[model samples]
Target: MTTAPTPSRADALIREHRENMTISSWASDAVDELGRLQAAERTLQRLGYQDRGGQEWAPPIGQAPDFDLIDSLRSRIAELEASKNARIHKLEMQALDLASENSILKRQEQAELEVRKPLPLPLPLSDDDRLRLRSDVARAIWDVMREHEDRCGHALEDVEPKHQVWDCADAAIRAMKDKP
Candidate 1:
């Protein structure tokens, strides 16, 4: 079967109006032609196409352009341009809003992934280090007791201070190893 030929710009404009639809390329071409006509009309109007007595301003005696028709066409073109601009602006705003929403979703997804990740393993301590920590704990407890005895003006009984210190040190080491 033979394919149908493309419609002319004038036919496209008429079809758009009659059916309330757009044929993209053809409609754009028609609009461009309308813009050119409006620009030319504006230039001719500014240059004074007719005299006060309705005679042609230039040497061509009988040809006075129709200013009223040109005015109507210009006004229609302006209306169409304004509508096109408003639609474009609205679409741009919607695209920006969608992009912002997408970014927010991505950040939220990253946060969820971070929450699901596993904790790191703790480092180990050697036997010598463990002994040193226990000794430190015993020294600190002894110093605190001596200071307390001096403040109270008496010597306090040392009841299993070594055992208490060793227990505290072991608890601290266990806590450190258990930490994520």
Candidate 2:
């Protein structure tokens, strides 16, 4: 029996796998960004800046600034800034990985295309020849069906078989013939 050449199938599988990996990578990045944003907000809160109108100012100018409060706020801000930098680093790493993966996929596809050149078609068969071929296939299928029935000790009576399979096969053959 004829089969789809191995390299074409392999390339298709590889492309699908790469696509899934890319989606997963992008989801991971989104989660990482969300976590980073949350952490930044928490850090800001820890720094003692109440959410008053749009501005953040230390206690009124004349009300003696508390040294302890100032120090705590400064520390929190520093921690938040460090966390932000780390998040940025993670994003950069993800970008690099995506770029490398894209390059590899492109190269693999190009190689596959080069390896599988197309072939010329065979001459068309006469209607009689086609009918004979179909009959042969049907007989072979009947043999397999009989074997299956014997092996399972079950009649095919309960099966809800339909002509859909034949229709699909006809469509596929037509499609193949139409290909250049």
> Model 1 segments beyond 4 Å from truth?
1-58, 61-63, 123-180
Give the distance in Å from residue 127's predicted Cα in candidate 1 to where it truly belongs. 20
Candidate 2: which stretches are off by over 4 Å? 1-62, 117-180
Whole-model lDDT per candidate: 0.67, 0.67
Write the residue-wise lDDT of candidate 1 on 31-81 in tens digits: 999999778666766655534444444433465667798899999999999
On residues 115-162, what C-alpha lDDT tens digit does candidate 2 reach at each position?
543333355878886666544444444456667666355333332345
Error of 1 at 130 (Å): 22
Residue pair clashes in candidate 2: none
**RMSD, model 2, all Cα superposed?**
41.6
- Per-model TM-score versus the true fold: 0.34, 0.32
